[model samples]
Target chain A: MKAEKILEALGEIDEKFIEEAMNYNMKKKFNWKPIIAVAACAAFALAAIPVANHFANNDMVDGGTTAGTVAPVPGDEVDDDVDYVAYEYSVNKGEIIGNHVVELKVSKSRGRYVIKDKLDTQKTVYLNGMEWTAKYENSWSETDYKVIVDRYTGVCNGRNMSFGVNSITGKCEFFMFKTTGDIDKTVKLTRDELYEIAYDNFLSGGYTEDPENYQLSDECSNGSAGYWFKFTRFVDGIETSEHVRIGLRNNGDLYWFVGNRIGEMKDVDVSGFDMDKIYDAIEIKVKKIYGDAYVDFEREGAVLRKRTDGSYVFDYSGHIDVKNSYGKVVQERCFLIVIMD
Target chain B: MTDETILEMLFARSEESISAIDEKYGHKCRKMALGILGNEQDAEECVNDAYLGLWNAIPPERPSSLAAFLYGVLRKLSLKKYRANTAGKRCSYYSDALDEIESTFASAETVESALEGKYLVEAMREFILTLNEENRAVFLRRYWFMESCREIAAALGTSEKNVTVRLTRTREKLRKFLEERGVEI
Candidate 1:
C-alpha cells in the first residue's frame, strides 16, 4: 500500500483555492480580514465562516510528538468521534470589494452528500391553526449523519422532537412532539396549542418561517415511522426557495419541524434575459464541459448569484437528460451557467 | 499566452499547443517541481510528464484555469518522482514540508477515516478563508506553492526563522481548530 502523501493532499485542498492563493501572492494585495479572525488564517483570500468559533492560543502542547519526526505507531487504534472537538464559527461578513460588502448566510443543513437513498415519508401537521398534510423525501446515511453531528447542535425534546442544523454541510432537521410520544394513537390538539409549541420550542433555532405564506405540498412516511408534512415558505409577498416541514406521529404529537431546500437568493430582475441567445450558449458550453454534443438540456429562468464579495451576477441553472439514440433516457445531471458581465 | 488561446490550440490538436504551454507555463511548472523534488533533472522529467498528461487531459476537461490544471498534473508527477527517488531514505524539500505538518496528524492512533479527501479540501478552504494577508501569504507559499520558508521569508523581506515560526504557530492553531470541529487528529 502506498503511503498517504500529506503534502500533496494539503496542496490540493482547493484546486481553485490554490489558484486564488497564487494570484494573491503574485499580485501582493494584502488582506486584512484575518487580524480580527481566529485560526484558519493561513488560507486563500476568500473569507469563510470559521468552522471553529472561539478564540484560543491553538499552540501545540509541549509533550507528545514533533512534526515529521514521529512515525506511525503500529497496532494503535483511535476513534474519530472522540477526537473531533471542533466548535464551528460562522462569519456573516465577507471581503469588502468596491463599496459593497456582502455577507452570505445559508441554511445549516447544506453540504455535499453522496445520495445514499431517499426515503418517501408523509404526515399531517397544523400550520398556525390549520391542519395540513405534507409529503417528504428523507435520506439517512452514516457519513451524512456523522457530518451533521460533528457540525450542529440539536436539542432532544422528549419523543424524538429535536432541532438542529450543521451549517457547513447544510443539514437542518427539527423534530417536534407530534403525538404523545406514541405511534399507535393520535392525540388531538387545538390551534392555540400547536402554535405555542411550534414557535417557542422549535422555531427559535435560526429558522425563519412565514405563517401567512405557508403552503402544504405533500405527505408520506416509511410506514414504520411517523409521517412527514412538508411546507414551502413565501417571505413577505415574494416566494423564496426555502422549505419548512412539520412531521406528525400517529398518536398526535407534532414530532418534527424541518426547514430545508436551497434558499431563494437575491431578487434580481432577469426579465431582460434573452432566452434564445442564452440557450444557444448553454448548448455549446454544456457540450464542452460534458464532452457530449447530443446532451438535451433546458434552462430555468435566470437569477442573480451572490458571490463572497457581496456582488451579484446573472446565473441560470438546468439539467440535461442524456438519452441514447433509441430515445430511452439513460442519465440525468444538473448543470449551472454563470453569466459574467 | 492567454489560457483561452492555448486552450484553443490544444482543442484543435495543434502541435504548437505543446510549444505554447512550454513558452507560457514551463518555467513556473519547473520551479514548482524543483520545490518538491529538490533536483533539476527530476524536476525537468516531472515537468515533461506533466505536459504530456495535460496534452491528454485538456481535450475532455475544459478547466476553469489552465495553469491550475497544468500545475495539478505537474505536482502529481513531481510527487511520484520524489517517492521513487527517496526509497532508501525519504529526504527532500517536500518531505521536510510534510514533516512539518505531520506533527498535527501523523500519529499511531490517528483516525484515518476522519481525514477524508473531500473533507480536508473543504476544511482547508474554510481555514484559508480565515487568514489575513501577510500570514496567509507566507503559509500558502510554503504549503500550497511549495516554496521554502527561506524563499517565502526572502520574498516577504523577513527572516527564514520568522516564516517557519509563524507557520508552525498557525499550523498548531489549525490543529486545534480542526480538532474543535471534530476532525480526527
Candidate 2:
C-alpha cells in the first residue's frame, strides 16, 4: 500500500476531530455552557436540592502515610459537576503592546468571614502579628503595599489567624481561618472528605451566598501540610480570581483556611478578550529573564477574575522549567505567578 | 482578533484578513509545514499559499473552526510539496510517519486493490472515534501534524518514550481495526 494514500486519508478525518486534537491544551473548554446552565438551574431550587453530596462523603481519613505536596491537578469529580469557564482564546502575535488598566477597588472587597476560633491561644497570634509588605504587579503598574487584615470589631475572636488586605486598594487580600483544634498525625482525610469540609467551611464562613456555584480547583491533594482543597469562585461563567483554600490535618481536622472572595465584576466578556496576549506576555517575560535559554512555560492554570470593585483580574499560574545550554533542566518545575493584570 | 472577525473580513474580501491570520497562526502554520517539508523556505511558501487558500475558501465556505480549516489547507499544500520533492530531499519526519501507516496496513492487502481512498478514510475515522481522548489526540498529533514524538511529548507534558509507545500501540489498534472492517490500506 502507498503510504501517501494513507497519509491523505488521515488528513480527510472530520474537522471536529481535528479541532479536538488541536485543542488538547484547552480540552476543558468544551461545550461547558450546558454544564454551567445545569448548575445554575440547580442553584435556583436550593431548598428542594437533595441533601446527598455529589461526591462520596465517607469519613475515610485513614489512608496514605506520607503527606503529599499540593499541586494543581485537572479533572476532579467536581469538575464534572461544577465546570470552570476558563478564558481560553488565541492572541495577536507580538510584543507587549497596548495598556489596559484593571483597577482593584476597596469598596468591592466586602466579604464577611465568621472567624470561629475554638482555642484562646489563637488570640495572641492575631494581636502580636508582625507587619508584612509585598509588591503587586500587573502589566501596566507595580506597587508595594502593606498587608493589612481588617480588625472587624465584633468578630476578632483571634480564630481568624490572618485577614489580609492590600493597604492601597483596601481589597481583602486574603482571610485565613485556622481550626486551633488538636492535630493528630495519623489522621489523613481523603480528597472527597476534605472537599466536603472545604465547601462547608466556605459557606459557613459567609464567603458567598451560593457555594455550589464555585468550581473545585483541579489541584486538590493530601500532602505534608494535610488534605488541601481549593474551590474557585465563578461569576457569569467566568472563573473569578476569588477562591477558598482549605487545609486539613491528616486526622481530618481543619488546620487553616485561606480564602479570597471578590465582589461582582461587570462586563467580563470572555469571548471578546484576547487570551493570546497573556500567553505571549508570559513567554516574553520568560525569554527576557532566561535570555533565550531553552524554556518550557507549561501552563498549569490561567484565571481571569473580578476584583470586588468590578475590575478584571488576570493571573497566570504555571510550571516553568528552564534548561541550560546543555539541555539539562537547571530550573526544574518552579511555580510562576503573573499576579492580576 | 477573533476568528469570526477574521472571517467577516474575509467575507468582505479585505487583504488584512490574510495579515490577521498570519499574525495569529503564522508561527504554528510555519512549524507544521516545516515538519512536513523539512525546509524553511518551502514551509514559508506553503504557509503563504495556505493563507491565500483560506482567503479563497472562506467566502463560499464558512468553517466552524478557522484554525482547523487553515491547518487542513496548509497540510494539503505541504503534502503536495513533499510529494513533488526528490527522493534525497524528502523530509524524514513525514516519511517516518507515513511509513508507520504503511506498515499498519501492510498485512491487509486483500482489499487494497478494491479500496477507494474515501473508504479507507471512513474506516480510519471510525477507528479514531473509538479511541479515548488521550490516545486519539496522540494519534492525530503524530500523523496529521507530522510532529516528532519529542514535540508531541513536550506539548502533552509527557516523555518522548511514552509518546513513542502510545503511537506504536495506536498503530497496532488501527491495523486491527481496518483489518476487521475488511478495508485494506
Candidate 3:
C-alpha cells in the first residue's frame, strides 16, 4: 500500500482514542537557555569587533575580576572587514587565523539542538557573569545589556548560583552557581530530590505554578539548558503546557533554573488551507535571510504556535549546513524553520 | 474546576457538568474542531455535540483524563462533519498533519491488510511504542495532536526545523517498519 493508503488506514483509528492517549498528554520540554545565551554571546562577539580588540567595556565581573581583554594587536585598525577571528583559548591547536579571537576546537558535537543527538561527555562550561547585546551593525535590532551566566558544559561541583536576564526576549534564563571542583564532584540528583532542592532554594516564593496539580515529568531538558529536570502541573484534570526546568549537574549541583517555559504549542488555528503557499513563503524567507551562508537544508517538520494576539504562527524546521565566508562550515545545525509572524 | 471536580459533578448528574466542561475545555474543543472542519458553524456544532457526547459517556466511562475524553469527542464529531459536508476534502491542520507523515508509505505497495483498519492501528500503536522518547513525542505531536512544527519546536525548545526533520524521518522509518513487518502500505 501507498502512504496515502496507510493514512487512510490510520484514519480508521478513532482520533478520540489517539486524543486521549496522546493529544491531551504533555511532552517534557527541553532547555534552550544555554544555546540562546551562548549564541547571543557569539552574536555580541561577532558584532562587537572584527579583529583582536577589547569589547571596550572593561567590565568588572561578579568576583571583582576583569574578563579577558587583550591589547589591540598589530594591524587591528587595518583589517576592518573580517567578521570574526579565533578565541583566546583556541590558539595552540592551529586554530588561529590572523590571531584575533578563539575558534571553538570542537572535537565532536553529538547534539545541541538536533534530535537524537547526545554529547559524548556531560561537560559544563560557564560564561562568568557576562553581559551581551544580541544585535549587529547590519541590523537595527539592539537588545539591552543583560547579565547572563550561561553554562553549557558538563555537571558542576560548586554551590554559588546567580540570575541573569536575556534581553533578546526579556526573560531570565539562568540561575547559576559557582564551580568549586571538577565533574567528579557532581552528583546526580533524583527527581524528588531535585524538586526538593529547587523548592527549598528557588521556587518557594516566586513560582507561579500551583503546586497542587503538578507532577515531575522528566529529569532533563534540552542540550542548551543543560542538566535540568522538568515538572508538569495540571489544572482541573487537564495538564497545562507550562513547565519548569531547573538546571542541575550530574553531581546534583544547582546553578540555574527557568519556569513556565512551554516548548510545545497546541490548539493552533489551522483554519485555512494553503500548504504549498506556506512552504513557498518559508523557503523564500530562508533564502532571503541566509542567502549563500546557508549551504543546503533538508525539510524537517512543521508546527503551529498561537501568537499572543490569538492568531497562529506556522513554522517549519530543517537541518542545514551554513558556511562562513572562508568556505568553512561555521554552523552545522538544525536551523529552526524560520517562524511566520 | 479540576477534572476530578468536574468528574464528580458528572457522576452526580449535575446539570452544571456540561457548563463546567465548557468553561474549562470549551475554547480548546472549539479550536480543535475549527482546525478539523475549518467551518465556524461546524466547529460550534461540534462543541454542542461534544457536550452531549460527554453527558452520555461520563456516567459510564470515568476517563482518567477528562481533556482527552472531551477532545476525543469534539475531534470525532468535527471529523464527521468534515467528511460528510466537505466531500472528504480535508483542508485543515489535520490534512497537513497527514501530509507530514504521508511520505513514509508513499513508495509501498498496497496489501490486503491495508483494508483492515484495526490491524493497521494496532501495528501503528506497536510501532509507536518502539520509538525513542524524542521521536515518539514528535510523532504524537504531529500525527495525534495535529500540531504544527512550530508548536512541537516550542514544546521541545528546539527549532521548528528540527521538529519537522525529526517527524519526517520518523514517518519514513514507520513506513519501513510496516514494510518489514509484511504490512504493505
lDDT for position A162 in model 2: 30
Better of 2 and 3 by DockQ: 2
Query: What ranking emerges by DockQ with the best candidate at the front?
Result: 2, 1, 3
TM-score of each: 0.39, 0.44, 0.41
Location of the lowest summed lDDT over 10 successive residues in candidate 1 chain A: A95-104
Best by DockQ: 2
Candidate 2, superposed: residue stretches over 4 Å from native: A25-139, A142-341, B107-111
Query: For each predicted model, how many residue pairs clash, with residues at least 3 apart or on different chains?
Result: 47, 11, 55
On residues A1-341, what C-alpha lDDT tens digit does candidate 1 reach at each position?
11233454565655666555443432123232433222222221112123222112332211110111111111223222221222222322111111111111223422111111123122332111112233222211121211111111111111122122332232232222121211113223333344445445434423333344655553332221234445567667566656654554322445443333224334555566565675677677656543442456666654555433344444544446553322345333332435455
Off by over 4 Å in 3: A1-341, B107-115
Candidate 1, superposed: residue stretches over 4 Å from native: A1-5, A25-341, B106-111
Task: Give lDDT tens digits, candidate 1, residues B1-185.
Answer: 35777799899999898886876567667778898888999898889999999989979888888878888888888878877888756556677677777766656245346656667566766777777766777777787667888766644545788888889888887777778879667
lDDT by residue for model 2 (A1-341), tens: 45676678889989988877765531222233444534433442241122122112322111111111111111112222221111101222221011101111122212112221211112211111111111111100011111111221112221222332222232333212212122112233444555677777776755455677777775655333344677787788998776766666423346443345343533345586677876687677666644555357765566665545335555444456654322345433322334444
For candidate 1, chain B by itself scores a TM value of: 0.86
DockQ value of candidate 1: 0.11
The Cα RMSD of model 3 versus the native structure comes to 21.8
The CAPRI category of model 2 is: incorrect
* Chain B TM-score for all candidates, comma-separated: 0.86, 0.93, 0.88
* lDDT score for candidate 1 against the true structure: 0.48
